[model samples]
Target: MVQSERAKMADGEWYACLDDDLGALRGVAADAVFEHNTLPPRQRGNLGPALRALLGGVGEGARIEAPFHCAYGFNIFLGPGTFLNAGCIILDTAPVRLGKGTLLGPNVQIYCAEHHKEAAGRQAGLEIARPVTIGDNACIGGSAVILGGVSIGEGAIVGAGALVTHDVAAHTTVVGNPARVVSRG
Candidate 1:
């Protein structure tokens, strides 16, 4: 039997993003996100439980500030001591892994999905997904955008508003659009 669109998506192959199964999954994720975002600040402690029910994995002491968003919550994995500041958005069309002690500043955006570069394919809603990995102790600054297939190395620091399109080396500091390494140790 041929593979389903969802199966192809999981395998990181090109697939239609508007498929019914994927839409249903997104609906479930949206509902969960809505509930999590709507909870009062006094009940912030309950956020972990809410995320645990939605995400692929949520390690101990991981905290995400309210108003977070994601395309598919189940594709996100957060490690121990990870903290995502307010307004972070993760388009987890594929797996998005944040390693232990990683810190994401406010409004950070991580996208694992990409639409076709050509107009015809885009019009058809064809898309592909790639996994994004942030290694242990990495710090991503406010408003940074990490695009699909990028891997941030352990202990790397991404400056505010960086647009990361390629892998960052361990212990490096990157800044600016199409992020360039400014320091390496």
Candidate 2:
């Protein structure tokens, strides 16, 4: 049997972004996100449970500040000690893995989905997805945008406002648009 559009999406293949099943899943995620985002920050009692229910997996000591946005919460995996500051947006069309001790500053944007390079394909709502992985002890500064298919290696540092379109080597520091390594530890 041929795969459904949702299956194709999960498999990281090209798929229709406007598929009914995918839209339904996104709706569910939106509702959950809305509930989580509406709660007052000081109300710590219910926050953890809410996030745990919404996300795929939330490890020990993982903390995601309110106002976080994702296409599908179930595609995001937060490792132990991962901290995501306010205003973080993860377009988790595919899996987005944040390893242990990773720190994401305010307004960090991670995108796992990309529209077709061809205008006609894009107009047809065709898209592709790729998983994004940020390794252990990585630090993504405020407003950094990590694009699809990028793997940031362990202990990598992405400076504020960086636009990362490619993989970053282990223990490297990258900054600026189409981020280039400024240093390697």
Candidate 3:
């Protein structure tokens, strides 16, 4: 999996775009620290607009908590009425599609790219990308990491701390590292 210098340069460019999008997020993170001390969080008003401006395109009524991070806002796409709890991170180096009505619990990380495991390739900072797709109405529990090229089927429930490396069947529940289908929810 040897990669060219051009690929490395492209990855660096992607990183730069991410830096630009997250520039506002740095302030959002700072705001969260003080936001909790306020009398009412609702009184603070919905900050969804602020976040939407930061991401690629956040659909109507999508609520994303503070302290969220994404690489290259252009690489991410989220549907309407989706809720992402605090500490959600997306490395959308490729493309990440989140369907409508999806719920992402705290600490969920979706990564859309991976570096070559070969030591020489890694040394060059070369990488490759694969898109991640989470289907409609799916619920992903806290601390789950959805890796690249994974398609989590519609209405599937991914348990807490699951490291999903494969595609999940529709309308099922999966758990554990390299997640296994536990039941049909």
Candidate 4:
């Protein structure tokens, strides 16, 4: 049976992060990420078998370039033809779903956890998991950061270096910190 902390994490509930079970899960992800990162370029097409096996789901043609990092691979799902460029990082404490044809440029970061606000709770390692979803054909530009609980609708575009903290409507283009909608296709 999975530990209570892990079960709570998977359920998207607030849980203490100091548990041994959670650390073990993170260690597994670290090993996989390390293997993928150190693999020869020619042998690491799409994703290395070790890394691929750790993920929850990988659709046909989905690819994540080397130097990719994730906290918990089992919570990530990539739809068909989705691509993540080099230096991408995903803290998948909760589910992170990337839809078909979605593209993430270099250095993109996706976070799925929010730490406790109070100092005492933070000291206690309390955190809550929130799912992040990117719909089909969306593009997240280089150096962008997608915060937990944010959803980007189909065909949305997030400009380079943007910080997204809110939902982005379908066919819209957003830029800048806090991600203001600049245009809609």
Q: By lDDT, highest first, what's the ranking?
A: 4, 1, 2, 3
| Number of backbone collisions per candidate | 0, 0, 0, 0
lDDT of each: 0.92, 0.90, 0.73, 0.95
* Candidate 2 Cα misplacement greater than 4 A, ranges: 44-48
* Model 2 lDDT-worst window of ten: 43-52
Q: What is the C-alpha RMSD of each candidate to the true structure, in Å?
A: 1.1, 1.4, 5.6, 1.5
Candidate 2 local lDDT, 18-124, one digit each (tens)? 98898998998888777778777776432445556878888888888888888989999999999999899999999999999999999999999999999999988
Ten residues in a row with the worst lDDT in model 3? 12-21
TM-score of each: 0.97, 0.95, 0.76, 0.97
Model 1: residues with Cα > 4 Å off, grouped in runs: 46-48
Q: For model 3, how does the per-residue alpha-carbon lDDT over 18-94 read when each residue is reduced to its tens digit?
A: 23334454455335434422425475344433344556667777776665676555667788988888888887767
Displacement of residue 175 (Cα, Å) in model 4 is 0.4
The residue ranges of model 3 lying beyond 4 angstroms of the native Cα positions read 1-50
Per-residue lDDT for 1-102 in model 4, tens only? 645998898888889988898999999999999999999988988998888999999999999998999998999999999999999999999999999999
Residue 61 lDDT in candidate 3 = 76
Question: In model 4, which range of ten residues has the least summed lDDT?
Answer: 1-10
lDDT of 4 at 49: 88
Residue 32 of model 4 has an lDDT of 96
Model 2 pairs in collision = none
